[model samples]
Target chain A: MAAIPRLTSRLRIAVTAPATVWLRGAAQSHTWNRLSGGGDRPRHLDLATLARLRLIPLVGFVVAALAVPVTASATTIYAASSLSKVVPSIAPGNTYSFAGSDTLAFQIENGAPADVFLSAAPLYAERLHSKGLCSTPVVFALNTLTFVTPASNPAGITRVQQLDRPGGYRLAVGGKHVPLGIYTRTLLGKLGLGRALTKNTVSSYQKASDVTSVIALGSADAGVVYTTDWYANTTKLLAIPVPASAQPLIRYEACVVMRPGSDTTAANAVIARLSSLAGRQALFNAHFGLPPKT
Target chain B: MTFRTGLFLGGLVVTLVLTFLFLLTPIAALLLQVPPRDLPGLLRDTAVSSALIVSLKTNLIANVLFLSIGTPAAYLIALGRFRGRPVLLTLIELPLVLPPAVAGIALLTAFGAFGLFGSTLAGLGIVLPFTQAAVVVAVTFVAAPFYLRAAISAFAALDRTQLDAARDLGASEAMVFRRIALPLAADALRAGWAMAFARGIGEFGATLLFAGSVARLTETLPLAVYAQLDVNLDSAVAVGLLLLAISGGVLLVAKLPPLWSSAAPSSTAGGW
Candidate 1:
């Protein structure tokens, strides 16, 4: 019974005793400061006063935002998220500001500036071209999907059909807007395993690059990713060939987005270079696979 | 009115009205777009209900985990001579200012398969990413800071006189905290919890990066919103409405603190 009071005292002191301690410490510091003629100031802002004062600047910012029109002067290149890694290498030291496909379209739709649009699928380029957002779409390279698993192969997945076998193992794929997701669905449908397979899917990321990372990270048992991604990361592991019969040939397409003071000649030079031997070499080097025989 | 006064009023009106519109228009548009006939059907859909259940469960777990650790840490900092306070606070609040994508990447680096302890975890047969558990962890990482920041300020603002009085009366420190300090700070802590809960419910970027948004599995409402936007608009609208309502409700509760429960010095005279 005596021990209980002691325990409670310790607990309470541990929690609430600090307030008094801090206050005493602060008071002592002030006394010492006065005795030594040292001056100090409070650091924290009075938040209530700040709230009222900040409104002035907030209004000013609104006025300024309306008055000033900001635009990038450099030639803008809109690329898919997957290019985040490979684009730097593709156009080493190229003078261009990159944007994501969604933001690019939104900006271009709202009359922002751009020079080139590289889409994961030809559909986006064609859509933009139809709306006069860009030039005609040109297919650049083909990508095939592959299934990647950790070296340990924890899911005991030896065959593609075993994926739908209802265990707790998580399967990762690309999101619906992603090219990989569409292809994965199409291929699964062809194999008559679409809905069943989806039931087991635990993650659908925005890009094939993200899927590769998830799989590589070992959070996912298996992932559907681009051939190039497999090549880039699968140095030790061979891609479980996603049977050619079931594979949907993925394409990367590009078109020059129209801009104010748009340089058709310079833009075409870049486009021509992408199809050029050096560009094709870069694409092949990345293992994006050559464009299928037209 | 004078010319300067009129101009000031006009600017103030513009600022306040524009700010309100900027914040509300998008959410209001979503709320208005909820087709009356489809509202029931959308809510009934497995995708909607499942995602809602998953979001609530995961966010609750995140909130609980945060408070469990955050409250004690706040207590330690608020009392006595706090050492390394700024460094400790910065570490705790890193996720607050971090972009969701960076937060996700950071989580991946620490907990993902190829992460810092990835191999060891793998050897131990433990993988966290792309799981429901991973979603809770991500939300907790992003949401805990809200509660911590609020609690810190609340504890800082507490009156030392009352605490000293309680101690002078021969009350144990535990009794003083239980009867005085805890009640005094309850209102602020409640608001902090609401903020944390709201933030956790709406967490997307980091959760997506760290946990992977899979429908009917790991996907939360935000993920469901993206998924439905990819396939169907009605589903997205319904799920979006649910998120807006929950987020709004949390803010409402935080703002209207006195209505629900009394934080009126209830513990001052109570025997602990």
Candidate 2:
């Protein structure tokens, strides 16, 4: 207990070193098995098996290491989609990941360890805050909701009012609980196209990226996704911004998730950098609207 | 023992120990997490019941499809002399090692509404993606290989002399196969079907991606478990336990003797 800090680092070192060696051995044995089919040794194995074996350990290491409660020197910040870019730009040395806002919260709820959570909505962070799982939430970035269609325009959808037109149009949207889904539903109702547009729905997938995939693949006629999602796929998908009057402001919030005896100084520092002037510029450059004035 | 044999035995020991730890521990613990008091309520849980209903129906169809198409393919591989047989076997087994996510996307690319063959299916007014049919397709794609591989092995293991003897006794090839080969391989085929059925029922990633997880629409047991994981873990555990129970039943059914007498012609199913 007294040598806790030292013990944890040593444990990490031990786990990774042997795990890598065993993984390599596993790869060799796999190749040997394939190559020496029906023998004491394998004769040949292709590059594909080698790649798969390499990825298994690497992914296992990441997930295992994160799941370990022992916090090392680095801070693990789980940011939501649009904020993924901030890690490389603002804090290159930290362990950063961008999970869907709902997924990150759910993971944390189920005991995923993270020092900081940068979420797409304050609702989740506030929930965690109320439960004492995280610090008070701070609003950071704002995103606008929009709809998109494949560039091929298979449905010939040209306007917001056209969204409701009867053309056997299939629509894709996020889960009902997620921020994007709530916003998309509100926008549809406000435009009086709620029943018409949502009725021919194929599926309400997990999150924003799923909605993007459905539309991008031309599986659905249109998808309601975040404006940033449209910007990211400018070539593939045509962005149709929601009418400003009906547009709901999506506020992305950040909070430091609690960890016993873990040094949160670095996590706080990372959050501070995100709200900094440079971070603001970086966010805008990446098409995120600045956090609204208090 | 020679040094090399000693090394091999030592490696095997380690392998068995590690495999047991990695595989059994999680399953044992997960099942144990289902409270004893919660056992009776598993059937009463709406989500669990609905998901299980979907799983049983889709998997039954998928396995029937497998037994129809895949059984013959397995028999051909096992008995037929053919060129490029290794290539054919490898092709059949390719999906066995595919990551479920990759399999899901692969199914989508080939069968989605705008997929390569999707437009053709659509022209006939059939939309597979996000439908119950898509779930069956995904299960068939992933589970058929399990059945085929096992069935092939089962067929291949038969004594060829018996086949030849029956043929020499003035039995037609079909007669020889029906009387001699079918009963001999019946147990193996049942085992294979059970494995494939279990795989189909346990499918998650591919089904979620290809069929979409709409509650009571395409949401099978695995999807229901996922949806309920963080929200209502008890219900999730109930569904998982149900799957385990079904899997156990499948194994037991496969292991038991045929319900009818083995000597009867009724026991012989399908062409040799």
Candidate 3:
């Protein structure tokens, strides 16, 4: 303990020396300007002014050096909200897992240190691919949007059209930007119930899980969530299917993000696993749709 | 310093340099990752705006509610003689120690739609989960203890003679509380408020599990930040910077002399 302070003082001196030299250069420039009659006298000068100015650059360098390790070691992956149920099941050995397509897409575009990207909807993935975030992504699986209600089924919603019925029964759907909610909206449009459903929609969530929780908890009379989400939440919910004509195909996609010069082996492995039979089985077990050929 | 001391000092300097870089890199990256031209457009996003508004509104309401109910309870606990005071204090502080996720689960188990009161609430046509109200409740549960603990300490620090002096001067119980006790405890109240606000603003797990991250409804800034990261990493950084800016502003406000002065010892000790 006694030696600690002495050591710290020496360390500070060593670290601050370069800054002090830079400051001296700045001071000399000021003096040269004054002697040459370049302009008015320097605004202010103090004994350690050079050290203080140099300190800023030294701190900046130190901060930049420290950040390199964290950026290199971690890979951020953006996934859809529905993946909240699936990712955790597979993420124990993997490097990254984040939910919500919009959130993920936003982060990746903003230059977060992300290596792999998955989205609930093909549109966002395609958008990123078009913008050169990655090569063209492959459709990995499918998702089905369904209505869920509490076990008691208080709203008695038997068909897709009933959701638009003239009643005060609350409905929860994902936000307009969320894939599941977009699909729900598309389905409603196809069924000619869009206007009515929009009027009665009480709340919109960022993730399907939020919608499912509302229905499962009986907060809303009904809510739209993915088929897999309903399966995962069996204890508190019952899934209700929309009519065939109104249902839209929900495709999941994945892409290997192309960093400037980094290796793509890890991303390729993820893609291969997703395409393989074992991966399909895992998806099936999680109640996600198997790719058509599988 | 001896050569050994000098060598140790060198090592310490290197470690600190590395540590400073580790902490500031992400924040620096957040600032640098965005194109200056795109920032305004990103800030205009409806989802981002709504989440920010919801976060601020909910945190404010939760802080007020926590302060109002927690202050008197803390005072009673701190000043009154009770056999189970320690146990009650511990219970009040229990939520503070639990992980936010666990707190969320506990809230769900007790108040979820299928929880103990779920059926009862349902029968009464009341819903608690996945609403703005749930967000407020979750924040309050996690943040109340900070205020309560601080308030208790502030109340305990008061000199009893001051209260006696107020009473002897013919001030009623309510007057004494208003003029003397409360003034003495102002510092604790402000500290408690700052703590509660900070905790409430950053609350995530409980809000996610209990309130549900409904866009434009229950989604807070952190949820917004998380959601952006899911789809667009750049957007996430932008949103994160926005959150960081707000947090920094709040911290500055909390530390300002006007706010800090209220908690200063002399002014809070029932000074004339």
Indicate which candidate wins on DockQ. 1
Residue by residue across A1-294, what tens digits does model 2's lDDT show?
334334445444545455446544554464344534725544364323533334434545667887888635778888876566555687678777676787889888777778899888888899889989899899878888877888787778778677655546667777676777777888888888877544564466666777787777776777788887888888889876567888776888889888675447877888888788888888888788887645
| Candidate 1 Cα misplacement greater than 4 A, ranges | A1-66, A85-113, A129-135, A151-164, A188-201, A235-238, A258-269, A292-294, B1-14, B28-44, B113-127, B233-238, B270-272
Q: Specify the CAPRI tier of model 1.
A: acceptable
lDDT per residue, candidate 3, B42-81, as tens digits? 8888888899899989988888798778877777887889
The residue ranges of model 3 lying beyond 4 angstroms of the native Cα positions read A1-98, A105-116, A260-263, A292-294, B1-61, B98-105, B122-125, B130-132, B161-176, B201-205, B212-272
Task: For candidate 1, list the clashing residue pairs, or say none.
Answer: A12-B173, A12-B174, A13-B173, A18-B80, A217-B113
Per-residue lDDT of candidate 1, residues B122-150 (tens digit)? 79987777678889989999999999988
DockQ for candidate 1, C-alpha atoms: 0.31
Candidates 1 and 3 compared: the better one by TM-score is 1
Error of 3 at B161 (Å): 4.9
Write down the TM-score of every candidate.
0.78, 0.78, 0.70
Q: What lDDT score goes with residue A292 in model 2?
A: 61
* Model 1 Cα lDDT, one tens digit per residue, A203-293: 7876566687767766778867777777778653346656688888688888887766776666677777777778888887877766753
lDDT score of residue A225 within candidate 2: 86
The docking category that best describes candidate 2 is incorrect
